[model samples]
Target chain A: MISIKNLSFAYKKKPVFDGLNLQFKAGHVYGLLGKNGTGKSSLLRNIAGLLYPQNGSITVNGFTPFERLPVFLEDVFMVPEEFYLPDISVPDFIKHYAPFYPRFNSEKFRNYIAVFEIPADSTLQNMSYGQKKKVLISFALATNARILLMDEPTNGLDIMSKSQFRKILAEALDEEQCIIISTHQVKDLENLIDRITIIDEGKILFDENVETITKKLSFRFAYDAEDVAAAIYSESSLIGNVIVAPNIDGDEGKLDLELLYKAIITNSEKITKLFQQ
Target chain B: MNQFFSLKRFTLLVLKHWADNKKRYGLSVLAFIGLLITWFVFTMLTGFDNIPMGKAVQQITFFLSLFAVGTFYASQYFRDLGSRSKGINFLLVPASAFEKLLCSLLYSVVLFFIVFTTAFYLIDVLMVAIANSLPGTEKLAGKPNVINVFKVIILRFNSDSTINFLLFFFSVQSAFLLGSVYFEKYSFIKTIICGFVAGFILFCMMYFFYEHLLPNGGFHKGFLTSFRVHVDGVNDHLVQVPRWIGEVFRFLIMYGIAPFLWIVTYFRLKEKQV
Candidate 1:
């Protein structure tokens, strides 16, 4: 579990998060969504203990992340958007790095690399960006870290690899682990993430589970004027007008992440009122 | 496991760092060897024409190269911390900050000095053997023997001077080591510039205090003490600080600088972010 309260951070006077409060629980894949410069990456870094908050406290697994104790580090792993791997073979990287994590599973790591189609004998520096990211993702999962924080893990992956990533991530997650992925690309993780957390201007605009979102709101096309009028948010599309309307009858539908993000950003008050009831 | 210090974790960190930098380090050492061989070949060719170079030439070359390249390697010990990609990987490693800093010190100070000395002597012994074997070189230079290079170098000067020189070298290297962490890019050049600026400032201040402020002072010495007298003859005499103070100054110069800079580097690394 990760808990953050009254968190404030800035870079030479440009405040990123002010009095921001948030929490993350285990056994769930959290999809952290936000527009550019909305502090999504910064928030993840703070939670990972990469950045120090000027004010307030952040605790992960009952340990202060900034302390960076071996006990704390062994349980937390972060895959940043831009990462580095040494110019060594995959097995060599494992030999040197895996011992730090007591629970690291080398067999699982090898299996993950095989599933990702990255050759285990290949030199990391010679591989492409997508291959390296896959390797890092594989290593992070294999570490068996309790909390996994990834920033744009799918950035360099091909379409096929993206789906494979989602599939592998879903299978790799243990019941005790907490995973938080921060990305502006929402659709890539649509089916994988169970919770949607939208942040705007350093504050969480909306945070709820997929079950809660689908339970309270219906996302589909409005065929008529009445349907369009009932939508809390709408946008024109090729088939018809896509709408996000209150599910008064407790109906179920796919959660439109893109539309939900747009709704939360443009019509936050109305959406908040809808969820409040 | 103690968070501040752990022998097991420190050893692991050192091994990991070596694994990550094995290629770069290997290449650097090989390059240094190649450079030494080249210098030896060139010196032999040049000095063979007139005075067949003896131990003095070899010693000069050895010490000069040792100071120049050794300091450079020390300064570049933490170069990976300059880039965000590498810096993150380095900082987020499970080892404590103290371990990380100690790893660099181990590489830059202890390992570097030992390796550099060994390599220098290897080339030196080989070159001297070749020179002694050649015709018409026996009378020009001393007979080649496998001499202990460390002893020869230290014995060139008095023990006190040798100790002082070693201390000064360590202090300068420590400053450059700190610069490796303090500057993001061009650390060597920045350290050089800063070093010159600081030296200039210190020299000017010392000159001002001794020359202008002291009013034409002249040294007056006794058996166990010394004093400086003001030309005005108003008994404005300046007494030298106690012998303990001098001893303390010597101790600081001999032992204080490296660890002090190392501690600074540790704190700097702790506050580092990427």
Candidate 2:
């Protein structure tokens, strides 16, 4: 579990987060949705102790992350968007790095790599960017760390590999693990993320669960002009006008992540009020 | 399970560092040996008289290479921290700052000294043997012999006291190590420039304090030991600090500097962010 309170961080003169507060609980995959430069990665870095907060504090599993104590580090793992891997074989990497984490599961690591279709003895330096990313993802999951922070994890994966990533991630979770994924490709993680937290300009615009979102909001195409004008958020598509509206009939429609994101960004006040009610 | 210091974690960190850098380390050692051989062969081929690979040559070669290679190696030890990707990898490793600093010292100071000394002596012995066995070498005025490197005194400021060059080398190398953590890019060059600037400032401060602030006197018994001043047509008087104070100062200068720099390096590493 993680708790952030009144956290303020900045890069020199540019402020990233100002009096921001959020909470993350175990047993959930949080989809951190934000436009570019919305402090999503910064938030993840702050939680991981890779960057110091200018003000306030962040506590992960009852420990301050910036202290970077061995015990704290062993329980938290971050798969950064841009990562580095030593120029060695996969086994050698595992041999050297896995010992640092007491909970690392080698069998799970092998299974994950096999699912990713990575060669057992492949040299990391020779692998493509996507392959290297997969290797990192597998290693991150296999660490069995209590808290995992992933930034743009699906950036470089191929189409099928994205599906593989989703499947592996879904299988990797447990009741005690917390995963916070900061990504722009929400569709790649459609069924995987159970909670959505959208941020803009260093503020949380909307934070809700999939069940609540489906229960209160309707996502579908509207053929009638009256439906289109009455919708909270609507966009013209080639087939019809797609819209997101209040779920008055208790229909519990499937959540459209992209449309929901658009709706929040464009008509946040109404959607947020609806959620609050 | 100890957070600050754990033997198991420290050992794992050391082994991991070696695993990641063994190839680079191996190549560096080989390159150093090759350079030493080339320098020695050039000396042996060019000298017409006397012992070409004598004590003087060995000492000069040993100290020069030690300073050059030692500082460069120390400056590069933490270069990974300069890049975002690499810095994340490094700082995220499950080891305390103390353990990380110890690993850096283990590689940069302790192990480096052992390996460098061994490599130097290996080349020095082989090259001296080759030089002494050359035909007509018996006619030389001096005998070619391998020097006891530790006993060599490169800095003899006074007749009664001699400072060990190894201490000076370590102190300077530690400064560069700290520089590697402080500066993000071009750490080696930046550290060297900063060193020169700091040295110049310290020299100026000392010069001004002695020449303008103090009486018309000069330090005759080495630096900071004793001062002799003219007393207006009277017998000159010598002022000196207590023997214990002098000894303490000497101890601090020779041994305290490296450990002091190491402490600063540790704190810098603890506060490092990516």
Candidate 3:
């Protein structure tokens, strides 16, 4: 569980986040959607206690993360976008780092490593970037931390590894743990993330469950460029025109993320009105 | 006991780092040996028989040993910076700033003092024995004994002058530590510039107050007079100032400035975009 209130941050007199507020709870995979240079990583760092917010407060599991007590540290882990492991074997790293985490499950770590096919004898520094990310992810999960913050985790992985990554992440989920993943590749987390939080212009634009999104909006395909007045947002595709229709009829249709994003940006007033109704 | 255990962990980390870069350590050791050999050969060739080798060794050991300390300290700081990929691991550890600072200071300064002193004394004894046995350098050697070296080390520790020297060394080291945390790039140079700029600003403020402000009767002369008297009264035979005040000042400056810099650094280091 996490709470951020009136969190504002600036760099060199330029505002990155202003009065941003949000909350997160356990039992859901959150997709932190945001554009480049939109303070996605900055927000994640603030939550991880890596960087302190210039103004406002952040509480994680009833403790200020910046305090970084042993109990808090043991229950929180962050997988940074750019990471390096010391020139030590996987086993050696575990041996040295595991004792710090009281709930560290060495057996689970070994199992995940085996399942992921990571070499036991390989030094982490010698591994590829994607491989190292996997190793860190596996180790983080094995720590049994209640809160995990990951940034751009699927950036360097190959297609197979990406799918494998998704599978492992899904399998690693539990009712007590909360994972906040910030990434641009929304498609990679299509079915994995249960909730979506979109941040733009230094503020959260939308925060809703995927199921709620599906029930509240309908994506329809049109054959021609007819101005369907009922359509909240419409875009032309090669095969047809894809349109987002308000869910006044109670038609439960699959929510097209790209379409929904376009609708929220281009016709925000209409979308907001529909949600209000 | 907590401090001791934390120190042990710090030592382990440093050893792990050294093990990871054994080649660099080996190169440094070879360079040290080469320097020692050059000094030894130069003394033999010059026929400097009047110079007491023991005293010369002690002097060289004291000064050159600082080089070992300086190099190790600088390298450790740079190495930690270079390990940015793993920076979060070190930064996020559940250790207080004081614990981390003490561990770093002790491992680099105190440990280096112990190890280098012991090893260099042994090397000095061996060199003296070899010089005494050589045909051309018979007068170059004195009584080669460990007791004399131990006496020199013990006497150095007991001397009041040594305490003042250590205080100054520690003060400078504290400044460097603060510098290490202040600037992300070229921290050493930035720290030096910052020190000079701060000192100059303080000097200018004092000069203005004494020259202009005091002339207008804006301040009390008794304050300045008392300050001068206080400073003069603290002057002593061995220490330039009373040891207690010097120690208190050192502790206050180091503890105060180091943590402030560390907190500034914590806020300054942002998460890099990938």
Q: Top TM-score: which candidate number? A: 2
Tens digits of per-residue lDDT for model 2, A221-269 = 9999999999999999999999999999997889899999999999999
Q: Name the lDDT of candidate 1.
A: 0.85
Separate DockQ for every predicted complex = 0.67, 0.86, 0.25
Task: In model 2, state the lDDT of residue B191.
Answer: 96
Candidate 1 residue A260 Cα shift, in angstroms, is 1.2
- Ranking by TM-score, best first? 2, 1, 3
Kindly report which residue pairs in candidate 2 clash with one another.
none
Q: Note the Cα lDDT for every prediction shown.
A: 0.85, 0.93, 0.69
- DockQ-wise, the better of 1 and 2 is 2
**How close to the true structure is residue A269 of candidate 2, measured as C-alpha lDDT?**
95
| Model 2 C-alpha lDDT versus the unseen true structure | 0.93
Record all residue pairs in model 3 with backbone atoms less than 3 Å apart, i.e. clashing.
none
Cα lDDT tens digits for candidate 1, B1-274: 7888889888889889889999988898889889988887887788743444466677667668877987798779878789877777877788888888899889988998888888887877887788777798667535545545455555644656555666677788888988988999999889999999999998999778767876566556532245576656776777786878767776776899888988898888787766
Cα RMSD of all models vs. native, in order, equals 2.7, 1.6, 6.5
Per-residue lDDT tens digits for candidate 2, residues B1-274, read 7888999999999999998899899999999999999998887778633477977778888888999999999999999999999999999999999999999999999999999999999999998898889888799788788888766666575432224567889999999999999999999999999999999999999999998998997887757888888787478899998888889998999899999999999999999989
